[model samples]
Target: MGQTSKKRGVGLEHWLVPQWPAPNTVFAYVTTRIGGVSKAPYDSFNLGLHVDDDADAVQHNRAQLSQCLPIDASPQWLTQVHGNCVIDALDDGVVREGDAAYIDKPGLAAAVMTADCLPVFFASKSGARVAVAHAGWRGLLDGVLENTLKRFPDAPQEICVWLGPAIGQCHFEVGGEVRDAFLQASTSKQGVAQAFRPSDTEGKFFADLYQLATLRLKAYGVCSIHGGGYCTYCDEERFYSFRRESRTGRFASVIGLLS
Candidate 1:
């Protein structure tokens, strides 16, 4: 597995560049909701059009992000149904109805917008392809990560992944249904059995999304994983958390192959 750099807060209008072993031909970044033109609550960098924010404000924010990408890439945003569907991002401007997308072509980017849900960036160690995933509990339970890995027929051991910001274990309280879903989602080798511990609340557990992701990835043979230390619910100044603020904005996590 590649060693991950400690995530740092990138200032306004900029991006949190994932510090990984990806080649120069591959560049990936996650936008912070710190710079843009939206107003309060959705103040500044809110990138999602589905959030009931002003459409103009969302479009303006997207434009602001597109300008900073490699080769001025336009992100292929998804409708993101929280399902397991993974698509090949072959064209731009069309929103796919899935939680994950991968691309082999250069100068085009695949991205997912999130507040507290985990944004997973994928890359081949050789820089031949890249992908991204939005892994909330539903997607995780229903096999979103596995579906994304299916897009790459190569040995999963050669794939490098970085998990972006999300609600961490400390605050991700879930009911028995969620725990049972995870337990029955995959085999024990995937570590689903250990991802939850009984919370103080009766019949509830504090779930570990990062740990769950690691188990799923390793189970699929992806050995090089990084960047799971961020807690979206805890970092109010840098990340937007839906759990913390239901009416808040969303940030974007993007990955693309470069020419």
Candidate 2:
């Protein structure tokens, strides 16, 4: 896995720049809960409008984010429903309804907002394609990653992925039924079993979302996986966790090909 770096310039210091070996034309970033205008629980960089933050504040934060990108880049934002829907990103100024956005055209970035849910970044080795997905457990179980890959012009092996921050296993506890659902969804029963460890309570387990996502990617023959080991719940200063705080805001994971 490659180490993710933080932007150093003024007003962009807290943003995360993925350090994977993506082609120079590919640019990917993840926003932290820093450098924005929202207040209190959503304080700072709250990117999700659906989270009940003041609409004006979110737009201000979004505009601030936009200034950090290339001059011609237009980010495609979506109303995420946590399903497997993936759409081709467009700059038509409409907020589309989907969980993932794919872009092959230059200057159009694919973006997804998440608080605790895993945000996955995908790009082709050639850097001609890029995508971002908002993968909560429901979306993962529903094949959101698979659906995103289907939009790529390249094969699974030709794609590289980065697993962004989420509620790590230390804080991501799930019921037996959740574990059973994943087990039922995969043929690699033993592999799937490894992603869950029995929590202190009976009939409960601590799930490893990163591991589960990696398993899913590997099952599809994608080998160049990177960027894991971040804990949104633990890093309160830098991330927002829905499980940690019921009323909170979302950060964004965005990727695009430079024009």
Candidate 3:
């Protein structure tokens, strides 16, 4: 991983991308495979505890991350079962087993872990709240983004979303069953069918996860969206890609308010 200048009490590490515009209310970031003490495969910055990394090392890495944040609230980690379950951040200190988390209270961090699955961050245009979703293919197919949007209780146009890094379309090959599930949800066969490219071999097709996400967001009337152009599986040096390194560590995408 690369190193960038550290300032504003937020370390600008090369692996992390901070959002533009309302940078104060929607503080979002993704941790790369750097700046930690986990061993190989987990390599340095592994933030997940269930991935077989030493428990002590995971704790140390998480502590280091806490030091970089602007608030004292601990990150509300998700069990991430790859379903559409979304938790309210008001239920702090409780481990929520879900694919997404939303926080209306300032200073409480909403977080999700992933290696190649998409990490979607959400915020209201008024900057009153923010959310983070761990959208793997299953979660996306099951409506994680839609569930996250439902929490807002505001018009879809009042929200802004940022799709974080994940395995890119070029590298995400899928079978017929995976394609069928998405197709079933399609409003128009022409539009959804375009999201998949037929593979040269067998019944496999290359699916664009970002494109799928965008379609879902569009359905809910969200327009101010960004990010979702990086492939963790391809960028080995900067990300801990699970598909690339089968038995590897997980990275985190986090969002919170500044206290």
Candidate 4:
């Protein structure tokens, strides 16, 4: 199983895929800074093409990832501007500006980049559809998850979601504006910031992105949410963290139907 180790939140191994009730035909996985050709900083296995890592090295890393895919295809990468735009995974020739990609057809993989931003994976109940979202605070506030969900025919509860590794509340310090944005995103403006607490520094808060996202999904009646609690900032060997180290590489969370 090129998925994950039984000891979930430990060192970086091969892959860090979600293990839940998604249909057997649905394929979803995340990459770590291991098992590839990248050198120091990126270390190894860095798949993002936009980062400053060597293009040849990234190609090599991605080629390694392509070998692990159940299908003989590469993931459809996006320019992810931390916006709400969602596109079809099939639309991947030139890198488009989008935060998410939905793929209904088998063999096409949808992926999003992240060093600290959350990577959200989606799969329809019957495995007819799969998608991946890049959810930085800006994207989440602007409804990237909402946009991605709308691309599928199923309702919120009919889809299964997995929240991948990201900067946790413990280390994710944010300004008041970030909190206000989430409050504005929520219709009720109630308890949306409950996960956010006043930081030791004035006018700052420790925002819980996972809580904020789960709250939004629950509002839309999404129930089968899994994964989270692994902090990228804390897991030095297992993940790359932009907040912790600026010149780091991005990993990916990908999803698609296995052909």
Candidate 5:
């Protein structure tokens, strides 16, 4: 995986650009908690409307995001339910119910909102297709990534993936049942088992989401993985973390082919 670099946009200065070798026609960005207007807790630049932030503020922030994008089209957001639902990208102003969205043509960007859950970005090496997925523990185990990959016409090896900010293994503690569930669902039981380690609590383990996602992608033959050293819980100033603050807002991870 390559290191991600930060770029300064007009209104959003701290947004991240995936450092992977995506084609010039493909554009991807991960917004941080910086920029925009909202009160504390949600603060500024909170893109999630479902987090109880003022709807107008979120819309304003969203408009700001759209204004800053290189493309003219707005991102198509989903009514994410932490399930494995994947859909084609649509920006008709209707919020679709899906955890992942993809598009083969340009114009519309696929986006997912998250505070602590993983956001995975996908782009074909040829820049003809792109997608983004919201993968929490439930969604990941339910095969959201696989479903998103299946929507692409390219083989897994030709797709490039980038894992966005999320709660890292250092703070993502889960019970033994969660660990067992992952192992039971995986073919590489031993390899997947390594992503979890015993915590101080007897029945709890620290789960490495980055490693788990990488393993899942590799299992599908996707080797061009990048991004993922961000811990939303640890980086309080830059990201919003649900585990850190139960009533926090959500940032967005968006990707699309440039129109």
Candidate 6:
């Protein structure tokens, strides 16, 4: 576990927390908009490589994040496509085009990048493995969380989850189609239908992403969960919000095992 603080020079502030009883199993934390070397839009401390930021600057920022982690455990980066596909990080083949990554192997890290999209982290209570998922509305509708839960060998009750910052309900306005998609997927779950409420603007509705995620997790029997209070679109200074800035940079959420 680590601690959160604002460091000068870098221009980025980071949040750190420990996974207590499971001390040996390193969990997840996110990077804020403050530190890094990218200019304008990207500002500082942007870790996204594919976002049109100067490659060299992105590389430098990534290096800074690496320095913060233990020397033995290198962070594993992924090519996210907002799909439910989950791959094993231990495989050294070409980067898989998917939304999630997991690993039971010690010293291997699993990470996902996001702006307003949810970054959900998972760890077995027994400390056997960990995973991270990028859950945008598309991915969520496609069953990303359910797919990731299936990756764990243990029962869903043994899995612990942490839902990272994302667009909150008040700021997450969606069309009727989006709400219908969730209602369709949550067929057996009766209360899911109410997660969407009509927005003040016509033809739009306020979608509670956090509530949807909780419903999905509970459906799968994963009840030990935490986090999911912040809203990226609402807090521009702390996080990068694609909805707020179409050309903005992305932040990262990382988790791995301690060697």
Model 3 Cα lDDT, one tens digit per residue, 154-258: 799988888889999888999988989998977866767888999987999988899999999998899988887899989998788877878899889988866
Q: Give the alpha carbon lDDT tens digit for every residue of 212-259 in model 4.
A: 889877877889999989899999887889999888888888887776
Residue 63 lDDT in candidate 4: 64
TM-score of each: 0.92, 0.95, 0.93, 0.92, 0.95, 0.90
Runs in model 2 lying further than 4 Å from the true structure: 1-10
For model 6, what is the alpha-carbon lDDT of residue 233? 96
**What's model 5's TM-score?**
0.95
Q: Which stretches of candidate 3 lie over 4 Å from their true place?
A: 1-12, 90-92
Clashing residue pairs for model 4: none
Candidate 1 lDDT at 26 equals 81
Instruction: Evaluate all candidate structures by whole-model CA lDDT and list the values in order.
Output: 0.84, 0.89, 0.83, 0.83, 0.89, 0.80
Clashing pairs in 5: none
Question: Across residues 1-259, which tens digit of lDDT does each residue of candidate 5 receive?
Answer: 0222222346656888888978887888899888879898898889998888899999999988887776666889899999999889877878899999989887678789999899999999988989899999989999999999999889998999999999999999999999999999999999878999999999999999999999999999999999999899999988999999899889999887766
The digit string of per-residue lDDT tens for model 2 on 1-259 reads 0222322333477989887878877888899999888998899889989989999999999878877776354589999998999999998878999999999887778689998899999999988999999999999999999999989979898999999999999999999999999999999999999999999899999999999999999998899999999999999999999999999999999898777
Please say which candidate is ahead in lDDT: 1 or 5: 5
C-alpha lDDT (0 to 100) for residue 78 of candidate 1 = 93
* CA shift of 204, model 5, Å: 0.3
Writing each residue's lDDT as its tens digit, candidate 6 over 89-155 gives 8535355678998888776776688999998988888887888999998998889999999999979
- Model 3, residue 147: distance off in Å is 0.4
Clashing pairs in 2: none
